[model samples]
Target: MTYCVGMMLDRGLVLMSDTRTNSGVDNISTFRKMYHWELPGERIITIMTAGNLATTQAVISQLEERNKAPSERHNSLLEAPTMFKVASIVGNLLQDIIEERATDNGQKAAAGTFSASMIVAGQIKGMEPRLFLIYPEGNFIEASFDTPFFQIGETKYGRPILIRGYERDMSFESAIKLMTVSFDSTLKANLSVGLPLDLLVIERDHFTPRHERRIEASDPYFAAVSTSWSEALRNALDGLPDYRMDPAVKEILG
Candidate 1:
């Protein structure tokens, strides 16, 4: 399992993903789940994948090959005129790859054994920044004002922080901080999701990544944030009012 989040804000976009994958308790490995494509001053796209490792890797490999071909291909993400088109291409590719794998494996392989999902986020020149959650069925939905962020894979453990703190106009710094806090909660709650996170930030209209960092287990800043968040939660709980029983009920019980 893995966790990836993409936020669309007034400042641009923020994306983060964990690098953990495991088939069983004894079979664990780390693989970078975030893939980026940029055509400086023209377009930028970042995709964070989760689910069946084989399906996701194959989808990314095909996309990369098309993008690197000598001639621009219509299916290439870089050739898409708008972010919406880019998403369509990706979704279709994912669906195709998954179906092909299933076909080769014969009829008994279970319907969703190799299912995967992706979070696509970035900007295309002349268009507003966008974020999308692409599912295994080749369908996707974009983030709106009411839902300014999208999270895929192992999402339940960390959704509360985003729901409580996300703002449309938050500064990039604040967005990144909020993301880290949410990720910390997941890290503590799930052994399947571990350290060495990939972080990327895109400034509005820049058509390129503004901030990028690989946060390892030993990163000082992440360590500080994790500690601070735990302390804050403890303090908040301590400050809450305790339950009080009615005097009559207390006397009766006594």
Candidate 2:
């Protein structure tokens, strides 16, 4: 129903997510899947979610509420000592919400229904930029040089490009371009994933976002990227060696 990606690069991190939710072919809506919290020079955290809209929204709401409470019994995003801790907190919250919803309804919630997964990326003042893929079970895995990116929800259509082109030390510009291309591939193959993408870039050790953008359907850069990528793919496919067989061999096989 949605697609979100977070890439960990040597220079920084890049995150992007689509903004579409649908109950059926006739019922469709747009809702942002990206959320960010910033403490200026101290910390910056961004979360991109994919799954049941209600469940994700509730988790985010509860986190925000806890952060604002006078006697915070737990570490909110702002209070987390490290990026790993922040991810653990988010994963736990997501798991709790899913369990509560499933218990109240007495049904096994389908994947991406009462269940959700998130990509958490950011930095605290003393730590390096980190990226995590938080699963529905309250456990997560961080990106490493071997696996420098994480994607969730409707991901299969977009994963090939990342697999072929991703580099751990790529520049910020190249990373965003690769991400845009990945999103473009998904958009072409799936109707459930739609436009108005949210993109955020954080340079290493900045403790703040370097770039944040919303790419609407009419955005020129997005349009150009999509068109160019399509053309390039077509050209590449055309250049691949074609299969040929001798007429006698073909007839014998037939």
What TM-score against the true fold does each predicted structure earn? 0.92, 0.90
Top lDDT hit: 1
Q: Write the per-residue lDDT of candidate 2 for residues 1-254, one digit (tens) a residue.
A: 99999998999889999999998878999999999998989999999999888999988888888556656544389888889999999999999999888878875655435999999999888778899999999999998888989999999999999999998888899999999999999999999999999999999888778999999999999999988987898899999965557887666666
Off by over 4 Å in 1: 66-75, 247-254
Q: For residues 1-254, write the lDDT of model 1, one tens digit per residue.
A: 89999998988999999999999968999999998989999889999999999999999888877556557444378888888998999999999988888878874665588899999998988889999999999999999888888898899999999999998889999999999999999999999998999999999999888999999999999999999998899998899965558887666666
Model 1 C-alpha lDDT versus the unseen true structure: 0.91
Clashing pairs in 1: none
Number of the predicted model whose TM-score against the real structure is largest: 1
